[model samples]
Each structure stands twice: as C-alpha cells, then as structure tokens.
Target: MNTRPGLSDTEPAPCLRIGLLWHSVNSPNLGVGALTISNIAIMEKVANELGVSVEFIVLGWMDKSFPVYVQAPNVRALALNGRACKPGGAFSAAVGDCDLVLDIGAGDSFADIYGWRRFLYLAYTKWLVKRAGRPLVLSPQTLGPFKNRLARAIAAFLIRRSDLVFARDRMSVDYARDIGVSRKIIETTDVAFRLPYEKPSPWPGPKEKTVVGINISALLYQGGYTRDNMFQLSIDFPALMDRLLDYFAGIPDCEVVLVPHVLSHRAVEDDLSVCQQVQRAHPGVSVAPAFRSPSEAKSFIAGLDFFIGARMHACIAALSTGVPVAPLAYSRKFMGLFYALDYRDVIDCAAETTESALEAVTLAFGRRDELARMARHSAALAQDRLGIYEDGIKDFLASRIPNRRPAPVAAKSRLSA
Candidate 1:
C-alpha cells in the first residue's frame, strides 16, 4: 500500500482535512440523503471536541444535484469536472491533498449484486485513496454475497487497503471475514439513528384512527415481485398488499397509509406510481405526498402507530423513533439490522412464501405492543452502538493529530481559618 505524509500523533496540526468518496450527496432516496447528513454531523462533532480546524471535501459534477442539508463553513463541497479521477486531474488533485479518505459506499453497495461496474468504481476509489498516501476508512457498510470470484477479489482488495472497516450488522462482519479482512473490522449501527428528527407540518395521515405506515419500494415493485434474489421468497407482492389492506380495513379504528420512499422520475422505478395503483385499488388506503427531505419523511414515520415497509431506511426511521416496524425484507441487510435490534416481526420476502409473508405481517400487527416496547429498547441500544463509532472516529483523529492544548484545571479552594 502507498503511504502519504500525514501529521504524527505528537505533532499538532492546526487544520484537519478529510475527503469523503461515495455516491453523490444528491440522492432521490431519502434514506441515502439521511446518511449523508448524519455522517457530516458525526465528523463535525468529533472535530469540534478536538479543537482543530476541520475541512471536508465531497465529490461534485454529478449528473443530478440532490439536496444536502449542510451549511457548515468548515466544509467545502466541490464538483470534479468530468471523470477527472486519473492522476494529475482536478479530482485526483483535490482528494490527494486530504489527510484522510472515507468511503461510505452509499451504505450498502459494497457487494456485486448491483453489477461489476458499481463494484469496480468503489475498488478504484480505494486504489486512488491509497495512492494518495491517505488513511482510508470504510464507514458502516454491508459487505456481500459475492457469487463471482472477480467481485470477491475486488472487495477483498479494498478491505485489505482500508485502515478501518465498520460493518453495521454481524452478517456484514462475517462477509468481511469471508473476504479475508482480519484487522480494523468493527461493528457499528447505522448513522441514520443519529439523524435529527424534524416534525412535519400538517401531517397528512388521519389522526382519528390508528395510523399504519406502509412504505413500498420501487425496486421490488419493478422486479415483478419475484423470489429470484439471494433470499428466494416466492411472493406476488400486489396480492400481498391487497391482503394486508383487507386486514387493516377490517380493524374498526385502523387506517392504512401508503408511503413511497423512492420517487424516481422513471415510471418503473418510482414508488409513488405503484402507490397510486394501490390507492385506486383499495378503498381505505391513502397515499402520502412526496417528501422533500429525509427529515420530513422520518417525521411522518415517527407519528405512525405501526409501520411495515420495504425500504430499509424508512423502517429504520420508524424504529429510531420507537414506533414498531415490520420489514418486508428482500435483502440480508434487513435481517442483519433487525436482528441487532432483536426485532422479531419480519416478513423475509426472500426466504418465505406469500402465505408466510402474510402470516408474518399479521403476527406483527397482532403483537404491535410487544414490538413497540422492543423498538424503544432497540432505539436506546442503537444510541449506545453509535458510541463505538464515535470512539473509533476520535481515536483515528487523535492518532493523526493530538489537541494542541489541554483543558485548564481550576485551582483548589482554600479552607477558611
């Protein structure tokens, strides 16, 4: 691995510079947006405590400019013109100067399930950072079920190069082990747990009845609702939704609200479109308006009495607020995160049949009280897990550069004669 000239632990640098390499900050997925904001907050808090001048560099010149909720003077967001990732390019120059490089990998795309192109992009970024002689940290991310050797090789190389790696769930940690990542492997909860909750104005769901939030993902909806994924749960999702709607409708004081997490402009990738279809098909089902930020979306989720969602982050929002959530999980990430919370009511869409999915949902609905209590406990636990991440971050920073001054101590009081 290439080494860079960084400040020694004994040397106090007046300024600390970090480069964040991952998906663009502007993301249509609210969950992605939430992660970006939460990460910045985490670093900012550590920087303030260390009493060092901190600066941040984020990749720019993306096809889409998603909204970011940061206004810190210390942080600078710059766009790399074109694909200037090659040496001597503007992008390379910008990141090369930074003291550290942190790859968030958009939280979960460390695997090759998406495609080799996505996997390669991340691997190349790691090589770039290593070449720059900066310490690289892999933030809380899901590793993978690499079906191909090439994907595994790329992932393994990145893991080996990383100075520190944080896996949000045990499954990811195990995967990292499988890839031969032996050191700097730490388990930490998702940063979304720390995102500030902003209460929505004029909440859309009915106040008179028990509000049940149901988020539908465009990914599954577009995939023809099949069981071809890593978890092969045979399901006809539309029918499952109908059955769920029927059950909720029978409850005298319960209301069902369709929450769309992804609002892609493409019809096939937009949850709002699928939600509209469900709204028209079901009499009692209501649809929520598209939210502008993750804060607004999570605020709406916080108000729900119960939540069942396909989007992991939407379910996370509910869980973080102590509102019980049952995830209709198609990925292992859900199983891993929910397991950490000790949440039992999950519909493993990849592993179970439609009938089993329905049974799981019904069981979750019947046990809302138990789930709510567990959620509260989990929320507390989530906070504690975040402490591990904070500690790791502070330790990493302290090793590079220690605080210049120690806090002043007060003189002892003199005793009266």
Candidate 2:
C-alpha cells in the first residue's frame, strides 16, 4: 500500500481500491446491465483523469463462469451468491482491501415493497459494508416506500451510516427525509440516462409508416393479467396490451413491433415469449430481434416513432433515446423517474381502470409527434443531470485522500527512485 498521508493540489493520489456491491451486472433486465456498465465507466474515467489506478471489486457478478458484460482490466467480478454461501469467508476476504464500498442496490431494492426476502438481502449487504470500516456510498437508486416497521428501521440504520446517498429522483429524497435520515443526500438522475444510444440505419418497420415499439413484462403478464394484480389495483394486463395493439393496428401507416427488454436464460421468465404471444394474436404485428445488451435495446428503441412499455427499463431505454413513451407504470419507481424528467402522461396500471388506461394510450399515440419533441428535450436535460452525479462521486473519492503533504518517508522514497 502507498502510505502517502495526503495528496497535493498539483499531483494525483495513489491507486484507490473500491468495491461496488448489490447489482447483478448480468441480469436479464438490460437496464441493470446499463447501470452496472455506466457506474464502472464513470468511476474509471475519474480515476484515470486523476492519474490514479482504481481496482473495482464488483460484488454482484451474477455468474462467474460466464463472461461478464461489463468487462474491464481493473474490474474483478466476485460471485455474490458464492460469497453469501461462504458468509464471512469470501465477502470479508474480497472486500478487506477495499478503501470504500458502493452499494448500487439494483436501482430499487432498499425497501420491502417487493417482499421481506429482498429487504433482508439488502440489509445484510449494507451491514457487511458498514462493518468493513470504509466509507459506504449508496449509489444513485430509488430509496423506499417502506410500509413495514422493521424494514423502515433497517433502511434508516443503513442509510444513516452511509457516507453519501444519491437518490435518483426527488421522490426518493423525500422518502429519505420521511424516514428521518440526516445523512448527506444528493438528488441525482438515473445513471442509465447517460447510456450510449445509436440510431439504427433502416428502422425496423416500413419507412412510410410510424414504427411503434411495445415492451411487455412477463412477470406482470403472469400475475393474473389485469383483473387480478399482485397489488390492489388490477387491470387485465394481457387484455390491455391487446387493446393497445388493436388500436395501433387500426391506424393507417402505423406499424406495431413487440420489443422485449429482458430475455432471461430461463424459458418461463423471458419477455420474448410474452412478446411472441402478442405477435401471434395480432397478425401484422412483429417482434424485434432478441437484443444482446442494453445499448443494443436502446438502439432498437431509437428506431421507434412511439413506445409503450410495461418494463421500467424498457421505458428508460425509449425515453433515453428520445422516443415518445406512454409508460404503463406498475410501481412508484416509474412515476418517480418520469416525474423527475418532468414527463407526464403515464398509464398507472395499479391505479387506473382499463378504460382509463386505454384512453391515456390513445391520446399518447395521437400526439406522438409533439410527445417525441418533448422526449428529445427531456432526454437532453436528463443526460445533463448525470454530470452532478459524476461530480459528487469524484468529490467523495477525493475526500478519502488526505489533503496533507506526502509523508516524509514516501517523499524520500520518491526522490531516491
């Protein structure tokens, strides 16, 4: 270890070790992939510009046997499941050398809204990071609508101890304040907004017609398909999707394309199958090619004239690419993100009736041109917001390096060398 006490204003600090935990880089959800890659790229750029090397210990490597999508020489992927199995053995050994720990938390696992199991997993990970005696940073992600008392307590405990917590939207910031957290909290936009998008040369459908992209979530489709919801509000999901397809199909010179944002290795969990079912039901409707990465999916979305999506990331992929979207929001995360972007016109599946959702979708489709213009402007602003997050991260890293002059011993060694 370089034992220099502090970095000078003129010179770069020594190598810094950072461990980024709690995000599955290889998740079927391409948005997760985008976040993972963006986080590493941002940190690496900061380190490189400062003339310091960074060793990233990525704790949420989903499958070590398989190649990680976010590949870098400095990034080391340690399987989280394997680490959990070994308990203190692997996690402690892997993270012991880290100077700081960043809990990315897969965007929105900080609360127990999904279930108690997820909350427990996140709590345990935060506890481990806190125990390491390093500055624990909560990367830009959604905080909570923690209904459970125990869950709220755990979240408050972990968040209070965080050196820095970057809430992706104002709602999350409000959430942190509601939970009585006094820690340093900065409201930032989703890092995925900064993901690179390339426009496809020949758009997926006919050039004469408008290309509308639809992304369906299999998880949502399976949970009672509308009249029944895992939550209180129930709109038949499949019926709603069918209605949207029929409405668009009736439009002159409009092409409907089913775009799956998640292609799980597991057959049942995959969005591709759900998209196919929709395609089969509608004769002229087409299914987009299975995308290999988030950037690829975003690129496909870039080719669309309009997008209506059930998956939050797919909506993100669309909005980030300046494609107009009528997000079928099933959770608060969607509302919060769109709210931050100042982009309204969302169809809340959990709150709206089938007729209301259909009306919203119809209005969105009819005003696609105006919505597209707004989306482009919003995306430009969203990308700009990422700069704030970058600065925050850089400052956090720099703070860890003391401001004092290099130790006499280190200075002597440098002089001799």
Candidate 3:
C-alpha cells in the first residue's frame, strides 16, 4: 500500500482535505440521491470535527444545478462534466491533490445489467486510485454477484488496493473476502443512519384509521427481467393493488399514499403511473404529491401507519423515521438492508410479492408495538455502526497522512451535536 506523508504528528495540518467521488450528481432517484446527500452531510460533520476541508467531485450532468441548501462553509461541489467527457483523468486530478479519497460503490447486485459500472463511476475511481498517491477508503457499500468477469477483475483489484473496506452487509463482507480484499475490512451500516427524521404533513381531513404508503421505482420494473417477466410483474402489481383496495375499502378510515421515489424522464416502474391507476380504480384513496427532497419524502413517510416499497431507500426512510416498513425487494441490497436492521421477517420483493403483502401490512399494523421496539433497536444499532464507518475513515487518513491532526473538537461538536 503506497501512502502519502504530508501531514504527520510532528507537524500536523490544521485541516484534512478530502475528495469525494460519486456517480449520480443531479439524479432524482431518492435512494441514490439521498445517499449522496447524506454521505456529504456526514462527511461535513466529520470534517468539521477534524477541522478538515471537503470537496465533492460529482461525475455527471444533473437535471438541475447542484442544490443550494447543501452548500456550506466546509464543503464544495465540483461537477466534472462526466456526461460529455470521460471523467477518469478529472477524477484522478481531483484525488491527486487530496489527503484522502472516499468512493461509494454500488451496493449489492454489482453484476446486474443496471449495476454501478454501467454509470462509469467505479471505472473512474479505479483509475483515479491508480494514478493518485493518496490513501483510498471504500465506504460501507454493497458488493455485486459479479456477472462480468472483466468488471469483477477490476473491482477485485480496486478492493485489494484500498486502505480500508467496509461492507454494508454480511453477504458483501463475505463476497469482498472471497474476492481477495484482504486488508482491513469491517461490517457497517449505511451512512443514511445519521439523517434526522421530521414529522409528516398533517392530514387534510380527519386522520384515517390506517394510512398505507407504497413506493416503487419504474426502472427496476422495466429492465433486467424479460418482457414476459416484466409484463407479469406489471399485471400482478395492478391485481395486487385491487386486492388491497377491496380489502381496505370497507374500513372507511383507511387511505393509501403512493410515493414516487425516482421522478426522472428515464424512469420506467413509474410510481406516478401506479398511483394514477390505483387512484382511478379506487376513487376513495388519496395520493400524496411527488416529493423532491429527502427531508420532504422522509417526513411524508414518517406519518404512515405502515409502508410497503420496492425501493430500498423508501423502506429505509420509513424505518429511519420510526414507521413500520415491509420492503418489496428487487435486489440483494434490499434483503441485505433488512437483515442488517433485523427486519428480515418483513421483506417481500416483486418476485415473491403477492396477496401476502396485504397480510404483511395487516400483521405489521397489529405488531406496531413490537415493530416500534425493533425500530429503536435498529436505530441504536445503526448509530453504533456509523461510528465504525467514521472511525474507518479516520484510521485510513491517519495511516497515510502523517501530520493529520485529530479532528477539531469544536467543529466536531457543531456537526455531531
């Protein structure tokens, strides 16, 4: 492992300079987008505590410019024009100057056709690490089933070279070990654990007896599977929707909210489409507006009595906010998250989803007290895991940057407090 030697204990620097490499900058996908935002926020806190300056190097064209609210004194977003030009050199250039570099890998399902490499972020990061002397830390990320031999070989090489590697699930930890990632590897939770949950919007009418929330991504429903398979999923989804409406319609106080997790032009499992169709079929259920920010989406979900979702982040948002969630998994990442949070009993993906979802929702509602207990447990566990992630970054930097001072106490207080 080649390490840089600018910041040593004898001559410590005032602040550590960090470069963050992320694939989706302006994406509307709530899970990935929220992860990027939350990761930046967490790093900002970490940086402040350490008196570090952080620069986010986003690698794509965004529908909108960088968000103004995310701009702060310690962080800066650098758009690398990833769409029009290759970002390998630019990523290398950015990493070369920083004390440390953090790369967020595509969680599990790395070999899927719609996996992370398809976006070119990993490829660029690999190149950047090869050219730069700074130590690299692979954050708590999901590993792939690795269908592509070439991509897998490259990923294996990168993992082998990283100073520190943290897998988000046991499966990923096992996979990384199998792939020869022999360095310091640890199991940790997703960084989104640090996000603060807000209360949901007030209901326009009297509160319903049960407010069921459902979130889905059209992209997953569109690709990976065959046309026949997708058609089946589409047909089955609507049928399931009807069954749910009929089951809850007679309850009088029950309502449904359909949340579209990703609202982009290319999105295919259109949550809006599902919401519209269900609304038209069942006139009584009311759907909430499409949410754009993580705070808004999470707040809306926080109000639900129960949440059912195909998107992992949607389920995460609900769970993080103390709302009971039954995830409809499309990939291993979903199952990994559920298992990590000890919510395995509640997960049901599209392949396995059926009338059973309705049953799960009912069961979850019945066990609200138990689920609440589990929620607190999961939150504490998530907090402890985040500490591991923070420590991993600190250790990686300390090993490489000799003069790196301990993160400033006042900055750390302001961010973490």
Assess each prediction's global lDDT (C-alpha) against the native. Answer: 0.75, 0.77, 0.63
Q: What does the lDDT read for residue 324 in candidate 1?
A: 86
Model 2 C-alpha lDDT per residue in residues 1-417, reported as the tens digit of each score: 333344456554466778888765566777777777777777777765554666677787484332356665566667676446355768777777788888888888778766777778778877877776777889999998799987888899889988888988888988888888877789888887766667768645657888888888887887722324564455878789889888987888989899998787655447999888878889899999988677778888888889999888788888887789999988788888888888987888998888889899989988988888888887888877888888888887776655423222211000000
Instruction: Give the per-residue lDDT digits (tens) of candidate 3, residues 107-159.
Output: 43334345554534565555566566777777777876565676777777777
TM-scores, all candidates, are 0.86, 0.88, 0.82
RMSD for each of the candidates: 8.0, 6.1, 5.3
- Say which candidate scores most in TM-score: 2
RMSD after Cα superposition, model 3: 5.3
**Candidate 1 per-residue C-alpha lDDT over 135-248 given as tens digits, one digit per residue, 9 for 90 to 100:** 989888777867688788778887887898888888888887887767668898898888788654554675777889889876676563232442344687767888888888
lDDT of 2: 0.77
lDDT of 1 at 339: 89
> C-alpha displacement of 123 in model 3, angstroms?
3.0
The global Cα lDDT (0 to 1) of model 3 is 0.63
| Residue runs of model 3 more than 4 Å from their true location after superposition | 1-13, 23-25, 65-69, 80-89, 106-110, 113-121, 200-208, 220-235, 350-353, 399-417
Error of 3 at 294 (Å): 0.9
Name model 1 segments beyond 4 Å from true: 1-13, 60-68, 78-82, 199-207, 224-233, 402-417
